[model samples]
Structures are given as C-alpha cells and as structure tokens.
Target: MSIPTGTVTFLFTDIEGSTRMWERRREAMQEALKRHDTILRLTIESHRGYVFKTVGDAFCAAFTTATDALESAVEIQRKIDKTDWGEAPIRIRMGMHTGTAEERDGDYFGRAVNRVARLQSAGHGGQVLVSSSTQELLADNLPEHIVLKDLGSRRLKDLDRPEHIYQAQIGGKEEQFPQLKTLDIRPNNLPVQVTSFIGREKEIDEIHRLLNAARLLTINCPGGIGKTRISLHATTELLDIFHDGVWFIDLVPVSGKDGMWQAVAGALSIRSETGIPLDNTVIDRLKNKELLLILDNCEQLVLEAAETAGALLAGCPDIKILATSREALSIPGETVYQIQPLSVPSAAEETQGEKSCAAGISEYESVRLFIDRALQIRQTFVVTNENAPALAQICRWLDGIPLAIELAASRVKMFSLKELYERLGDRFEALNRGLRTAPPRQQTLRALIDWSYDLLDEEERELFMKLSVFTGGWALKAAEVICGSTAPLPVTAPPAWRDFIDPDHNYTYKTEGSIATYNDIKPDLDVIGLLERLVDKSLVIANQTDGSTRFVMLETVRQYGEQKLNDSGKSRETLKRHLHYFLLFVENYMTQVEDVTQNIWDTPIREEYPNIQTALKISLTEKEYYEYGVRIISSLFTYWQYHGSEMEARVWLEQFYPFPDYIQDPLTRTWITLMFGWILSSTLD
Candidate 1:
C-alpha cells in the first residue's frame, strides 16, 4: 500500500504502567503485550490505518482520514478491555491528532506527530484523547456509540501553546476517571516564550537524564549560549513528573544572598513569619514540595546562590535545583553539565557536500537555528549552493552560539547574506545587538561578553587580550611563552561593562567599549595558572583532540579582546611578539621537533594557518615590520604551494607590491622581486 503522504491523522498509543508491569511480571507482561499488540494491529488495520512504528507495546500509526484515525483508536480501546488475559489485564492509552504531516521513508514527523505523542501521555489508561483538530474533523460524524467529552483548554506538557482536548467515550457509557493529566494540574511560573524554541534536543535530553540521577544539575557555558532558554524548556517538558510545580528564578538583578532568597520566596509566594527570616521561610515552604527551581544568571551572585541552593537542598530532599551560570556552583551533589554550542557545517561541507543545498544545509543545528530566526525577518530568503557557503560561514564565524546566530539572522531584515558575512569581520558592530525586549546582558553580543569579561581580575584580562593575538587557537605553551611578558598593561578591561537600566525604564545594556576608561594598575601577567582558571570560568574554552588540549576563544571573544588591544595602544608590541613566535613556528623550533631548524612542519602550518595569515597581513601592512613580513611570506612559500593557496597568496602579496621606496635593504628587495615573479607565474600557469 502507498503510504499516506500529506494532511494525515496520527494515532499514538502506549500501555499505562507498562514499565512497572514488565519489571514485576516479565512473562505475564510479555504475553499480555502480545495480545495487546494483536488487538491494536487488527483494529487499526481494519480501519485503514497504516502502523508506521511500534516500540515496547506502543504503536504510532497514520491514517489518511481523521475519521479513520478516530474509529481506530476507539476500536483498539474496546478490544483491549474485553481481551482474556488470565492475570495481567492490558489497558491502552491512546491519542489522536489530525494535521498536515509529510511521510519520510514510511515514517511520519512534524508538529502533528509530536502533538499526538503529547496527547497520548496526557490520557489515562482505557481512555482515548483527541485534539481539537481531530475533534473538529469528527464533529458531526462521530459513530452513534462514540461521543467526545469536551475538556476545555488545557496546556499539554512540552507544548508551548495550550490545546483544547476531548476525551472519547466509547460503548455508549461514560466511564469515570481522574482528571486529564495536563499542565494546569501543576502550577508554574515558567515565562511564556514568544519565539519558537530552536535546536538543543540532545542538550535538553541530556539535562533531563542528568537531573534524574542527581538533584542539582548546573548547565555551565559561556554567556549567551542559551542556557536560560534551554533550562526553561527542559522544565516545561517535566511538568507531569513533579506534583507541586516548576519555578524559574532569574538571578540577574540579585546581588547578595538575601536578594537570592527573596527572589525564590517571591517566586514561590512564601510569606515571612514573625520570627522566621525570609531565607528560613523559603526553606519551610519548600521542605515538602517536590519542585524544580531554575536559577538563571547565577554567575554574578554565584557564591550567595551556592549557599542558598545548598541550604534549600539540605532542607528539602524532594526539591531539585537546575541552575544556569558561567561557572559551577561547586556544591556537593551538583552534576555540572557544560552545554556546548550547536553543530555547524564545516566550510568544506558548505561547498563540497551535496547536502549543502537549500533544503539540506538546515540539517546543521546552527544553520537550522539561523534559518528559523531568519524566516521571521524575511520569509522569502532561502539558502542555495551559492549562498549556502555564506550561511554556513556566518554560523561558523559566530562559533555556533545561539544568541550570536539569532542576532546575525536578524540582519536578514536589513542586509543581504553576503553583506552580513562580510560585516562579521567586525564582530562587535555586526552581531552586537539583539531583541530590545531581552535582558540587559542578552540584548547585544557585546553586552553578553562584557558580563564575562568584567568578572575577570586584572591578570586574567591581560592574558585574555594577549592570547587574542593568536588566531584559530593556541596551546598552553604558546600562551605561556608569549603572554607572560612582565609588562604592566595600560588597562585591565575594555572601556565599559554595563548591566544597568536607562532613564526610559528599559532593561537594556551598553557594551560599546572602545572608551578606554580604566585605572592605572600593574597586574603581573600570569599565564599557566590563570589560563586554567579562565577555562573554568567559561571565559576561555579548552578543546581536547588527539590526546592534547588546545585553549581557544570564540571568534567573537577574540574580536572583543582584539578591540581592547587596539584601543589600549598595545597592538604594535603585542602583534610583534605574535609575529616572532610564528616566525619560530614557521621554522621547527617552536614545535617538539626542537632545535633551530629551517624545515617547517606541515601539520602546525595548517593548524596555525589563520595565525600565519594574520601575521603576514599585519607585518606587511604595518610600517615597522615590512622586512619581517616579507621574510615570513618567503618562509611560508613551501607551505603555501602545497596548500593550493596560490590565489590567496597572490592577493596578499599584491597589497605589498610597488615596494615602499624608503626601504634601502638590498636583500629584502631581492627576495621581494623573486617572490612576486614566482607568484605571478604560478597564477598564469
């Protein structure tokens, strides 16, 4: 039979208490499951339903018509109730939803499939739940014995919008059951999110899994990584698990420990007693309640939050705490989960893979997130092979971070994709702004990074800027060798770091930090110990591959630090040191091969390719290092030839051509003339 293609009805079923039954009575449950499957399969098939998937006594079927789906669900429940199982009786919970869903390889997916699954979970055993769409379909044509009891608007778990549910009563008798398991049964203060939740399915699943094993699970990542949104979404999915409720407490305004306790109390509506303090009242109110507390933006008040979370958890055994911070709370029984950025397609995939076509490029999580937000701005915008590389480049340039991607996507309303990609070289101006309604720190990319940067001490800020001189990434040895210079820096921070409200009462931020207003302080730059600490603080990322770790910054972060270096009037000396290090790196001296050697390593050349390019650009363009720049280009000749960078090399060298007449150095002139001729010949060939 040809599979149902579009505008189909999905019927999802599960055996209530199936897991407990399997554990307690494996053999009996197995036999009961076989009988249950036979009843459902026969009834569904008899009603012209296509069973797409079955898992552990559950069935997900699709029907061409909503009437057929409704009839199948009602028939399956009746058949299961009357079946003769000696000891174990099987009760089936069913859900029916009708919407437009496209079939893929004999399976179905879309919001319809998801809605039906959520509907099925909201029903009790021996009952069938129907969505409003399905109910509207069967409005006049419900069989004589079947009637739908209208269950007015109820919010289903994991669904953003509320659903109008209906209970299908079969056999002409109204069976009494408990209330429909919906979100209204549990109270929550979870904020109503406006935009659609984008990628992070795996992260959300991992968060839930970790929460099941431990009470306190903290999602630690750099700022603007979407921790607050992901934590709220995860809590919404878990509404049915906790009886009391879930509460999202934003700690952005909280500065002290009392403010932290008061925030929780205010969220929970806990009133202070005569002698009991607000903190104690919070504990007393939550002592017996089984609830989830989401503490967001705790990095500012991390110590106070840690103390408050510790006290609350110790007071109540049933309460679980999920926190979002730049660093861990470091309390006992805390499961720290570092949420990484979304998956982005490599530059090679963007151009080389057949999958980079318009429809296929969205397979990358970061690209999908971008496309989702971009659609809101310009619905007609689409990705093609020609523009797919630019789209992939945008996501990669922003390091696959969600907030940065969203901000970049917002520019589709103003600029073309190519203009957006070209403007990303100045990361601050291109991706700095976000939705004005968002929190202060999140309103702009600059504000977000400033929150993390301002938290660093004098020494960390110095090393952070020094480390930015290396492109792509840097190893610990490179950071130690170059950043440990005993120079007392001019400033420890960017011009400004603001997380304040303006006169108009808008909760916005200002992070335009080319304004270099800092006190004169001498912070002895410490590299080795401080780099590790910065990694722990989420200001820096330590990527481990091939059994060796490389410390790196997000390109946005590097840009921020680079902006500071340029503003502080330190780029000449700092960039000179960077050029010298790579000069040795171009030779084999900087690597483990040791000794002053002329032979260059291809692997390091490729890994540090961006740094080499930056060095060449800076040295040749800057007046002080024209000779050294020419020397480095000569050194990279073999590396560039093998790398097929002939066109790129030609472009870089052409900028330095028609040599500066002030140069009287004969050897420099000789090497320059030969290099230009060689590149010109290579290009012609």
Candidate 2:
C-alpha cells in the first residue's frame, strides 16, 4: 500500500486483550488475528484508505478524507463484532486523527501518526475514537447510524495542550468493555515528596473517617498553614483502602471548569475522544472505580472546582474527592476539615526545665518541625537551654504556620535562633529564604499573600486594603460603613463630612441612617458579596460572635494589605474615610443610648476600640484634621470613661489644646475643655 502525504486522516487499530488471547488459545488467536487483519484491510480499501503498515494484530492506515477514515473505522468495528472464531472473538479498537504528515519509503511519520496511535490506545475493544480535527472534517457528513459523541479535551502523552476527542457511535450488537486500558493502567500519579512527612497522625485518621463517611472532603486553611501537606499525607495513608488506587490532580495550572476536568483526565491518563464532553468522560471513567482523587490548590478556581466536585459525586458513586483549598467547596455532601497551624509551646512550657530543654522543645509539633527542617540545612543544630526560648519564640512569631517555619528554618545556616526571632518582626523580609525549588508564591510570606490578593477584583482588592484599618477585626456593619462606600460622599452630605471629600470630583454615598441596608450601592460590586469572596479566597476569616459574623484578617495578611495600601498611595484617603465612618458610627450609637442598654452599645465599641484608636492616631497627626480628631474623641468620651483609659483621653485632649485655631466645631471645643478640666481635677485630688 502507498503512504499518503499532506493533511491525511490516519486510522490505527489493535485487538483488546490480544496477549491474553495468544496465551489462552494460541492456535485460535492466530485465526482470529487473520480475520481481524482481513476485515480491517477490506474496510480500509473499500473506503479509499491505504494500509501503510501492519504489526502483529495491529494495522495503520491512511485516507485522504476524515469521512473515509471514520467510515473505515466504523465498518471494521461492525465486521469484527459480528464475525466469530470458534474460540476467540475478534474485537478491534480503532482511532482516527487528521493532520499533516510526511510520507517516505512507504511509511508515515509525524505528530499525526503518534496522535492516532495514542487515540487508539485510549479506547476499549470494538470502540472507535476520533480526534477533534477529524470529527470537524467529517461534520454533518457521517453516514446514517454513525454519530459522534464529544469526549472533551484531553492531554495526550507528551502534548503541551489538550486535544478534543470524539467517539464514533455505531449502533449494533458490539460488546461494551471496561474503561480504556490507557486510563486504568497507571491509576496513581501522586508526586514523590523530597522531604519527610511529619505529624498529622490524628488528622490523617480523621481524614480517613471523613472520606469513609462523605464523598467529598475539602481541607480548608489559609496559605502556608499546611493544607496540601496534610492532604498528601492523609491520602498516602489511605492508599491501600482504595482498590483502584489514589490519584492526585494539581489544579494550580488549571484556570476554569473545562481545564479542571482536563487536569483530572490527564492525572488518570484518560485521553478523551473528540466530540464527547470531557466531564461525561470523567464521570463515566470514575463511576465504577473505588478511588480517591486529591485536587490541590483549588481556591483560585473554587467555583469551578465546587461545580466539578458536585457533578462527579452525583455521577460517580464510588469516587471520593479529597480536595485541598483555602475554603470549603460548599457542595452537597462536602465535609470541610479546617487545617490549623502546628502547636507551639507556651512561654511557661518553654521555661519549665533547663536540663531537659531539648526534650521539652521537641514535644511541641511546631518546634519539632522547625528543628527537623533546620537540621536539613544546619546538621549540627539542636535545641538547648541557651536557644529553647528563642526557638519557641520563633515558632510563636510565625504563628506556627508550617510554610513560614520551613522558610525560617532555611535561614538557620546564617542567623542564630535569637537573631531569627528578632528579625521575624519584619516577616516579609525574614521569610525570603525559601528554597529555590519551592513555588514562587511560597518563596516569601509577601508573595504568598500577594498571590491571594491578586485574585480579587478591583472592588474586592480595595475593600481588602481598607479592611486593614481595623486592628483586631470588625463586624459586617462596620465594614459596610467604612469600606463599602464605592461612591464618594454626596454633595448633600453634612459639610463636615463633605470637607474630607475631594471637591474636584463628584461624590455619591449610599443612603443615610439605616446601617442594615446595602441596596443603595452599585449592583455589580455589592459589599456583602465582595466580603464573602474575600473570605472564600481565605484572605479574610469570618468568626461567629453573639449570633453575628465578624470578619478579620491574619496579622501577616493584614500587614501585607497595609503595605499594598501604602504602595497605592491611598492610605491617607482611606484613613480619612475610616475615621469619618467610625465617628458617625459612634454618634449613631450615642443617640440610641437612651433606648438601649450599656452592654448593647459598649460591647460593639469595645470590640472596635483598636480600630477607633488607629483612626485617632492618624487623625491626631493631620494638622488640618485636628478639630475632627477632637470631635471623634469627644463623641466617644463616655466610651473612654467606661471602657477606656481616662488618662489617655486627657493626653489626647492636651495634644489638641495647642491647636485650638483648628477647632471649628463649638460643641467639640467645649467638650474638650470640660474633659481637660476634669482630668486636671482628678489628677490633683
């Protein structure tokens, strides 16, 4: 047969379980192989295809048109499925792909040839798989009874991008076999860890229990808290429990819902045929396999991941998903395991025994981890009485975050434990010694936070930075008042509030007086949704307090946000808004004091004291805003008297005394004078 050149469609065929047939019925297998070769060749010739090569029971043929190639494949499957050898049935799997190829010495070679072979390998016996290119060429031209089912995009061996695959459905009595051997041959694809896995014994057991009870388990935690490590360790322990084997799919490189399933198919070595939806291919492949799929780094693509997990759980009964993300998938049957930081010894525990300092230090999981990682770089490093306190201090400073601890431990070759602890105050700089092989985001604490920050939309990013104004944390109502203002202060607002606004630009604020209402804002950038997105991205954490949710950031993340706010050169304006909002918040509470109990007003004020103090500090420094500062401090005088320091209030009043010229508000001026007089009397008496 003559080899075809240029854009030619290649069809490759091989028998399923051919080796087993040869061993069980060697004589009958030879006869069956002969019949398979005869039927394939005849079908190719009839469809204007040329058989280029034949190896054992396999045939490689080429045709000028995809229609001819697909037609030949369908006919071969039909003929083989109907024919019977006394002992062996000739079930042939065929694959067709269209691409440009070079013909030399009666042979075909190039990516097209290799692709067709991979496609053939990805099919079951009596099934015909076609590449998307071939399916497109044969679009609306398939013979009656020949239909194409899209299998979605797939990452074939050695290919950079995924290729769409399709299955040629020929209605008949053809035998339906198990999933393609190409996908099932190598079920597990977990990466080998370079370092030893540590701790999480209880976590591993609990994960096992959760997996047994729930079809989907997501390990949720902030970056650098060790979610990935814990999931990997837990999966490794449960390897034997899964009969089909455990597979790991890294979704960091995947961007959307389509790419997510492609990653899963690639990990399972399932090369989807063109024309069939990839999700369908995944569900079909996993429906019967009792296996565990570990999806890592799903936070950025959480919505897509959640949808895919939900679909898989609903479609595949025996497939369980163990996903590692910054937050829960929120799908039905999903059990979220929030991974916490490793435990660090308390100061008392660190100082308990001088002679047994090393033993005591090793007892805490965080310190033990630090020492182990430190030994990797500095072999002679060991815990002793001289450095136990510093070691404990280092772990505590890093908040027992595993990634931070590992990065810090990497610096032991240069800095002493004490020096490391001292430098941790500027953790973004101290944690820069990450291993070169680590991912870019894990290279520095700032980079880790930057990654999560970059994923936010404009409004979300703005809200995140503005949220840094709160030191401890703030309630949803406070966030709405402070950071939810997308529009500027309206012209109709009080002149005192409008004075802080940029008069050069138009300003519009949400309707006044009702703190619970969020309807008077931009529909696209709702404050509630932005806050929830921040929480979902693990940038902000939500805590339950007195039946309400309070959102806060980790100290490290807040510092990063503050740095971003400073870099944006908007810290001054944001602080102004923060101070203005808090002043109004206090005023509103004061007016309601007659109807509400002290606890009602004091509880929230006490919770926001740190934020109020931060705003006051910034306000006090701005000479032009000194009057506003005095007004805010005076408005909260009762709060200061009941819940804060009377002496501190007096000091603030004295700071503003020298700037009386800036005091435009008469009531604020009089209140400041009265507070100053009372502080003087109390100090003297």
**Candidate 2, superposed: residue stretches over 4 Å from native:** 1-187, 196-202, 256-258, 272-282, 344-364, 380-397, 486-524, 587-602, 635-661, 665-685
* lDDT at 507, model 1: 33
Alpha-carbon shift of residue 271 in model 2 (angstroms) = 3.9
The TM-score, computed over Cα atoms with residue i paired to residue i, of candidate 2 is 0.61
lDDT (C-alpha) at residue 264 in model 1? 94
Worst 10 residues of 2 by lDDT: 491-500
Overlapping backbone residue pairs in candidate 1 total: 0
Q: For residues 449-532, what per-residue lDDT tens digits would candidate 1 score against the true structure?
A: 888888888888888888888888987766765676644333222112233443544332223234222122223455768988
RMSD per prediction, one decimal? Answer: 11.7, 23.3
The TM-scores of all predictions, comma-separated, are 0.77, 0.61
lDDT score, candidate 2, position 525: 43
Query: Pairs clashing in candidate 1?
Result: none
lDDT by residue (1-685, candidate 2, tens digit) is 4556779999898888787789899999887777777777788898999988887788998898888887778777667767767898767788889998755446665556767876786777778888888888888787877888777775454233456887788763334555443432344666655565556767776888798898889998889888887886677555556889888988888998899999999888888979999999989988999988999998888899999988988898888999999867888888988777788877666546742375566667888688767876876676677788888888877878888889999999999988888898898888776778899888888888778887788888988998888888988766776677645432122212211122333221111243322334342347798888788778888899678888888777888899988898888877876776666655555544542224424466777778777777877878766766776676565545544366777777777777776777675566567667766665564
